[model samples]
Target: MPLNLSQYLHLRSVPSFRTILAVSVLLRVGLILYSEWHDAHSVVKYTDIDYRVFSDAARFVLHPTEGNVAQGPLGKRLGLGDPYTRATYRYTPLLALLLTPNEWLHPSFGKYLFAACDILAGVLMHTLLTSAILPHADAHSASPARDTDKHYARPSTPPSASPAASPTRREQLAMLLAATHLLNPLVFTISTRGSSESVLALFVLLTLHAAVRARWAAAAALLGLATHWKIYPFVYGVACLGVIGGERGVAQGWRGLVGQLVNWRTVWFAVVSAGTFVLLGAGMYAIWGYPFLYESYLYHVHRLDHRHNFSPYFYAIYLAYPTHYVPSSEPSVWQRVLASPLASFGPQMALALGAGVLFGRRRRDLVFAWFVQTFVFVIFNKVCTSQYFLWYTLFLPLLIPQLSMTPRRALQLAGVWVGTQALWLSEAYKLEFLGQPVFFGLWVRGLIYLAGHAWVLAGIMESYEP
Candidate 1:
């Protein structure tokens, strides 16, 4: 039979995943090669700041002797000091170890590694969507129930309380979602520039996949490794706990409620997660020692760089910054407190915990809870960056398929987010690149951007099926 216009257009809109993956890989590899060529040839060379740090760190990891790094050409050029302190390498030694192979292959080999992980993450999400993990409503009951002993129990393929799209529809949606993630400018740029968000993304997706499959040990281990890799992921431990607590934990009575949380499973999950995190930390300490403690993890807590940031609190941090370095300070204690990195602690934790309680029970497969939690955490975070956006956006494709939002609404919200970013970036460029005294103006713009972010988040809340 001949295909109608709508069917043809729909088919065109959702291309084959294999084709999409191939194009994505080729584009990333081609971009890496072109970038290297341009950097080598052009007077104005483009380089990602962190890529060099990653490369240098990997080199230092291979030859860790202090005299060797200080004497070698690599050390002379990159100024390789303590691996953690050198080139601002604020990461676990694992990344340096992971990327050392790239040094043998090519300088840009790390970019290829990041890109491969990026595509693989999308592939994994698509695979899970098509599998029995995120089973549609027709395949299983949506409502939660209790076993004879009042233990929380539910059907194998249950989605949120709502009926899910048919399997065929979900497959198409999964394809489109995977393609969206692969082509998203934010995700694409990060991987192209050799950021490890893709690597982190793979662990995150794997943890969620394992949790959804009831493989508690695997989930906990992956989650632990992820948390060790990036401190922020530690917050998602709540969501993982929710998975172990109960898929739905029937809300019929106190017995079901007791079974939901106070159980062996939750304890085992916590123990394994904590154990894995401790082991990784101990290993890193043995290799890198005290400096690793300060640079990789501790530095983040007290870090304060108020020079051109997106947070509205930057102005406060800036004012407080001057008081610390001066021999004599006259600013009030309140001003000093504002300058401290801990200023945003209260709201960040409150909102994150609130999101966890709010979204824990209702999930689209397994991501809705963590997605909401991470979104709340990043927006309210003291230090927000482009890579921070990737934390939550990683799961967006999976969540979007289950959202009640239309394509048009999603596009509009996306425009709002982009427009706010553009507004902030324009001001940022003026202050940073043009040497303008628009600090106050930029702070106000940050406030506007914060409002824009909150507006977008509210829309997401409204559209969420749960």
Candidate 2:
């Protein structure tokens, strides 16, 4: 039965939810207005350069070829070219199709769309965590738990244990996390710049929300849609399977893990995911042809951008680069080495799988395991970017209630992370803008940034309660 608005308003958590929603909405609205004013006054506008790239893609999608009166639509094609030709746009054609209206509509339309998705993601995150913790709210005692990382004591309340003069504990945690994502300046800045990663994030959040509710098929389809759009979401597929198996109380230990993987559902998940991705790609292929294929899928597989890269290996790759480079039919041995999972991606996969197996023992474990998996993924990615941080941060806040770190300790670690980034950015700035030859210096900074993140992640791991 559908509940009425009044009934919803009277629910225990509604007021807090409303507060979160209202504050977030107001903040976004204010940012939009501020963006307009800033664009009017400042050279560096709020909207990012990607907005222009998206607009160009929309233009191409709207008119795939520059139409001629005499030649019809088959003259020189204006569709998205290969990455080498249309270097500005290197993503799926579906994004261009989705944003086709932006060609005619205002540019802010895209920003509004991405921002809406970003806010929606926060709502889903809250919903997933709130639902997850509610059932077990009454199952635990309210005794304070000892923080193991340091010798500090923290109140470990039963999930939403009712208390005098306060809201339910779970609701507060959920609202806090929701607010964290909604008001985060990093996410806000990206969404304002009209990045589509938030759209991808919304679908991934939906996938998790569906899986937590024991809806396996929906989870697989949603995740598949997300993976087709971007490759990183595939890492969370194991968490979805774990949710299904752990919820149903399968066999114990490694046997349960194996049983989880060897089931009909797992097979169906694979089939559906592949079917969805292939169907989407096939549809786009039928329209855009191989340029779409190469730019969207193949390019990322062999991507080796040695410039403006954040990985520590950038210097090594730069030094190893051929003095006089030429495109070839076959991948060079060095290219193969970089592309190989054993060399670059093996550690990330292994860590993600280990985190899934160890921490993904139940539905409650999904969010934390997801955070860890993504943490490892970004840290180990060959082309880590600021946008990639959004992936892990999507789930990181969900673990705050479960984490036993003190405010001061968390801030200390955050400062360490920021200092490392500042160190790298200083060198990178000189090279990129000032045109200084600081490639080796930037490489040293990248290594420092990598180590700093690893240290911060270790601190986070130690602070996690489960």
Candidate 3:
């Protein structure tokens, strides 16, 4: 018999589900209000404040002809002619364009704009994960064992052993993903702040979704915008290219890979992406003048060498010999070579390329490869700030349904999330203890925080098989 619509509605309207949804909405609204209030309280009354540095940079790009930077003309009026020196401000011209409308509003208003973007990004993430995981669950007829197998398999497939399956298990998986997205502190914080991380994350999710659907042009365009906002997203193209190539191979698994990449759509995406980047760059140069653009935009890419050495290995080595070692001032040839050693690069690239080489042979493995490639780049980079966690946050939720997660593992992840929030809030509020050493409390909290993250990352790697 067909299920009654009224009955289904009654079941879904159960107190638990409705209560959870209500709580999620309340938490989101509360975080947004808190962030807005915090920024307002921190305001310097008649004077402009220096927080939200990225937003300020965006405003500068939007009004380059006015000889302004991201912080606005208020800086000039206050005789603080150069805000760039006080903050690291660099953003793509496209992002600047997005912030143009907000530039006219008060900085507090800009905070709201950022918070809105965060909420939208979270919604999109939920939708993408739902779409991505539902098919596998349905194929298993809602069998938990089959669902578990599919989660860990390379090329997830329907159980030929049982053709007549149900949708109960699929519904369960969707609920879990929704719960994770709603409760994850990292996601909550990013969404509520006036930061570009959430927007970049939205673009990342869009790019991945487009790629899966074989919408090459749309994917490429989304990727172009993502890269323009932050350069990290561009590296994902390497993984995508690998997938395309792998789809064409046969005996060597080359046939399906070659066919996917040589298509007209892929070609169009490439062309559009190149053109978009060039046009955007040219526009910035024209408005800001080459000198200002070079110093502000180009300089960051060139100056990455001298930044803090944030890799685990670097931190370990530095701590072992604190007084003897000094951080490099710029990217010297040796520093670049050491930072991205050939040995590490070769293996990482091989894994990405190899995943492409074996594309349809294992669908689950391909996603894992892409995740590992991105993770390695971020974790081993020359600078590892707390904010850098945003990159991992962007993709980790998508992998939850695909991994062999246990209740224990889930609890550990929960613990790590809570620890991260405590550390982040402490840092954000500049909380101090007893004022013995001004930075003492922060340093102790930071060490504990990094250790917690390291534990979670290790757990993830151990759980991964492909």
Question: Using TM-score as the measure, which candidate wins?
Answer: 1
Error of 1 at 460 (Å): 1.0
lDDT of 1 at 20: 86
User: lDDT by residue for model 1 over 28-83, one digit each (tens)?
Assistant: 88878888888899887555778888988888767646443433333345544446
Q: What overall lDDT goes with each candidate model? A: 0.72, 0.70, 0.53
**How close is every model to the real structure, measured as TM-score?**
0.85, 0.83, 0.66
Our tally of clashes for model 1 stands at 0
For model 3, how does the per-residue alpha-carbon lDDT over 99-173 read when each residue is reduced to its tens digit? 555667654554455555555555655566556544553343334342244434333334543221234433444
Evaluated at residue 2, the lDDT of candidate 3 is 12
Model 2 ranges off by over 4 Å? 1-16, 33-43, 66-86, 134-169, 248-256, 323-342
Off by over 4 Å in 1: 1-9, 67-82, 132-169, 248-259, 323-325, 362-365, 406-408
Estimate candidate 1's RMSD in Å.
6.8
| TM-score of candidate 1 versus the correct structure, residues matched by position | 0.85
lDDT of 2 by residue, 181-288 (tens): 988989887887778889898988888887777677887888889988998878787776665655667557677678976677777877777788888777666666
- The clash count of every prediction, one per candidate, is 0, 0, 24
